[model samples]
Target chain A: MLGALKRLWHKLGSPRWFFALTSFWVSLFGWAALLFLLVGVVWGLAFAPADYQQGNSFRIMYVHVPAAMLAQSLYIGMGVAGFIGLVWRMKLTDVFIAASLPLGMAVTALALFSGSVWGRPTWGSWWEWDGRTVSTLVLFFLYVGIYALREAIAEMQLRARASALLAMVGTVNIPIIKYSVEWWNTLHQPASFGLTQKPAMPSEMWLPLLVMVLGFYALAGCVVLTRMRAEILHREGSARWVGEWVAGRRGS
Target chain B: MYFDSFTEFLQMGKHGLYVWLAYGSTALVLLWTWLSAQQSLASVTRRVEQQAQLAARNTQLAARNTMSGGAATGSEREQNLAGYDESET
Candidate 1:
């Protein structure tokens, strides 16, 4: 098993292998995302029970919670990819970091936007300086910062190194973002989902939410894989395999 | 199904605006993310195709020049060299 795992790890380091392995994943995740999002949205919006206190404003949770969760999760994924790149000096990991940054930034922006929109009706404010909100904002900045840092460095090796270092270092804020609500008295409520405990909401409400979360993950997968493929092509354009791939694409 | 009628569902217990806004913007963002990635992929694919074509052209030019005992025109050689430099970047 260890030998197999090591072999897989080595295979993953090759951009051509990664690209070929994930070609089908892009379409698979795209279809899954569409199906899951459709079901989850319809269920959450029209079928799920409304909150007694918040009424249908609670429907916003379907989009808000998933985006918020995915935003943080993507950042953490980037940090891990960055660590792998820095440690293994794997080219694929750097490509992953580059590919994921824009998606992560977009998702974080969506999370903040959706949250504030949800906030207006529920909290009677469009914006707040609370701990959870501020920390999440900082997370958004971290994505932007790393992206800019990568672009500003023209030397490819230096660019990857700098962005990887920044991504790994920025992971410190993730814990703070996770625990900010508990650590400080804040307007933001505690997390809705947890692994070890039952959800505070009933099954009827959380089930659609579960679907939406999965849908968001599928969407992320679709986007990241597509972007990664593009990054791989761009970085490995000189490779003989890349030329063959381009020829094949043209023939097809 | 939760509401009595279509109108009531659209009204969304008078919180329709916020709920729809949130969902609408989320949809837009998600759409943009997917579309932009597709765009990036298409753009990169085009670039790689162009690079491949240029490389092939350069290789053909080099081979022809070599077969001709380096009798290729200086201007033609310079153009081929320039293409090679462009493809290198």
Candidate 2:
């Protein structure tokens, strides 16, 4: 099993293979995001019914839910990259870690800020010291620290190893952030938007939420793909392929 | 189907500000990420090509100078110098 897994990793981890995969993902996600965003925004904003409880305030769920989900996914992704880079010593894995940092940070910041925005009207306060909120805030800071640490280092290998260590340590907070609401008596409500739990709100509410979620994932992919390609060029700048590709682009 | 009109639905009982802003920011962030990535790629490529071209130029110039100057004759010079030594049998 381990041998097969190793073979698969080696095959997939190659630059050409990885680049091909990213290209497919970027194209698919880009188109999917556009389609979903259009349908979601048009249907949701224009056709969905307003919530009885929160009135118009509930509409914020469209953006709020997706951002929050992406935030969680991004942290896990960073941790995964860090693990792969540290374990396999794949330069591409390190590239992924470096590239993923900004995207993860962006998502984290969006989640934290949007949650604050939503909390203002719903909870009647702009800030809360609840477990979930605090943990998520820490998650954002983790991303920031990784970002800064990567830039602070001069050597690429040293930077990758160092950031991977930080990423491993910080990943411990992810589950803590997710379960904080359940584990502690927090002011924030439990998960409203997930696979298992049905949305407490109406279909009109959830349909748009679904659209937004799909759109957000697509958008995240596009962002990641773009960054990954750039990272490829940066790391492999001296490589024959990168030189040829960049020359083609410049010539065109 | 449930909505009377699409425009009316989007209004969300006048909570459009928050919804639109949220959505807008998502779009913005995605764009920013893509553009930034492209920018870095361009710079990296440029730097690498510059270094490669410089190295190639240096190697070519060195080769030309060596060819024009001819090969080193250190061994031949040493043999000649040995023969001239007065004490050598």
Best by DockQ: 1
Candidate 2 chain B has its poorest 10 consecutive residues by lDDT at B80-89
- For candidate 1, what is the DockQ-based docking class? high
TM-score of each: 0.94, 0.80
lDDT of 2 by residue, A1-252 (tens): 999999887976777567656867877887898899789877765667766777766666677678778887877887888888888887777777777788788877777777777777778888899898899889889989998998899987899899988988888998998899899998988877677877777676788889888988887787777677777766665677665664666689
DockQ of each: 0.85, 0.28
DockQ value for model 1? 0.85
Per-residue lDDT over B38-68 for candidate 1, one digit per residue giving the tens place of the 0 to 100 score: 9999998988898989888877887998998
Tell me each candidate's RMSD, in Å, in order: 1.8, 9.8
lDDT for model 2, please.
0.75
Measure candidate 1: CA RMSD.
1.8
lDDT of 1: 0.91
